[model samples]
Target: MDNYSVKKLSKLAGVSVRTLHLYDKMGLLKPSVRTEARYRLYGEKELLRLQQILFYRELDFPLKEIGAILDDPAFDIVQALEGHKKALLARRERINTLVGTIEKTLVTLKNNTMLQVEDLYEGISPEKVQAWRTEAMAKWGKETVLEAEENLRSFSKEEMDGLKTELNDNITARLTALMHTDPKGPEVQELIARRYQIILRLTGGQIKMEKLEYFRKLGELYVEDNRYTPVNGMPSMELALFIKEATDHYVSEQKK
Candidate 1:
């Protein structure tokens, strides 16, 4: 049986070596064999197992949840793949709607045209946005709600949409920059610090490490709410996960 080293496997799988190590430590993946020197080696079986793992991760399953799902002896791999296919298709549809909305808005802006109120609400329901505001206020406090609402309401609907789109792009850019960075590296920690600073500014300094962790834990619940998750094409859960992971590393280092 052919076997690949961790480096080779990571390259083939398009994931970081650090991520692979974390997966192994989490028991989400394991090497098929170990050399006399204790080097991990992955064979065909490991590759298939990793494929399933990656698929679940891509579907946004938390590592723990994915571990439980894959560890069950009765787990039907084929059925899971079929289910995943359906989910992926649904996700694609949602992204398409969000992307189309953004594209249309961009077209309007480029032409210096003011969008109609109906067009402003394209791919979004005002009721749902209101519900999001309600939930956010309940969780974060009335003051936080009032601030966000006051700031957001100042923008016209088209302008608000543009702000959301720009924020999304900024998040993606920052995360992508951090993706290849070592979690323990000084550069990455600096980026994390910058992120924490922004968070603090937004929360008016009420969001420290303890409160931040609390918010992070409840984040998935917010994402479960359709009003939050399907906004602007990206799942808010995904953003939450990214922030959680980045901050987890930072906090761990800061304590030490």
Candidate 2:
């Protein structure tokens, strides 16, 4: 029968001899035979076992868990291989997204432009993006969501950065400063108007009739979604709700 010594198996498997020794010590993998000279040798069965071990390792399985899984009497090689294939495909998909994001970033840098918010989230799954769009459409209508997306995509990187800075630094900072004040006070109302203006700037003044309602919904999102709550290094649910209340009052007054 063909066999490989520790050194040979290490070279063939691309695993370190020390790692193989450690596996042996842990009783995770054992040599098929020990030569008279006290050298460990692995036969075909051991090689196949090592391949399984490597596959599990690639999936980030703990060595103990891998050993337990492999040692399970009900374990099926075909099922395990199918699971590995599924995991590898998912990983490849994420890698492809990251690669695309990198390419876009490179182009943006070459053109001296800024990246869009969606660009920052390029590595997120498309399913998640679709889910967000679906939720927004349900609340704000499809036309509003599509228009917002189009408006966001139309901006250059520098323009997006300026808008983001205004929202983060100016609006958020001012809102946080008024957290203890009345949500419907004149000062807070003015800041809410400024917030609406920033959104209009982001949408290039195309918000028109949807401006008040859009800002109101955005404020609700800031309060409801932790993803949108944090700004300028402050992550406070209370602060977000306060902004939502202020925008709600502003929208109500504007309607009269």
What is the alpha-carbon lDDT for the whole of candidate 1?
Answer: 0.58
Residues 1-256 of candidate 2 have per-residue lDDT tens digits of: 5379888888989999999999998988999888899789899988889998998898776798789878887867577668877978999999999999998887677434323445523446667766866775776567765555555566555555666677778777777667556544677656655666665565545445466566655654453453333545321212223343444566796789
Candidate 2: regions farther than 4 A off: 75-157, 160-256
What residue pairs are clashing in model 2?
114-157
Instruction: Report the lDDT tens digits of candidate 1 across residue range 172-211.
Output: 3554455456434555444344444444332234457664
lDDT of candidates 1 onward, in order: 0.58, 0.66
Error of 2 at 51 (Å): 1.1
Find the candidate with the highest lDDT and give its number.
Answer: 2
Error of 2 at 46 (Å): 0.6
Backbone clash tally for model 2?
A: 1
Q: How well does candidate 1 score on lDDT at residue 233?
A: 51
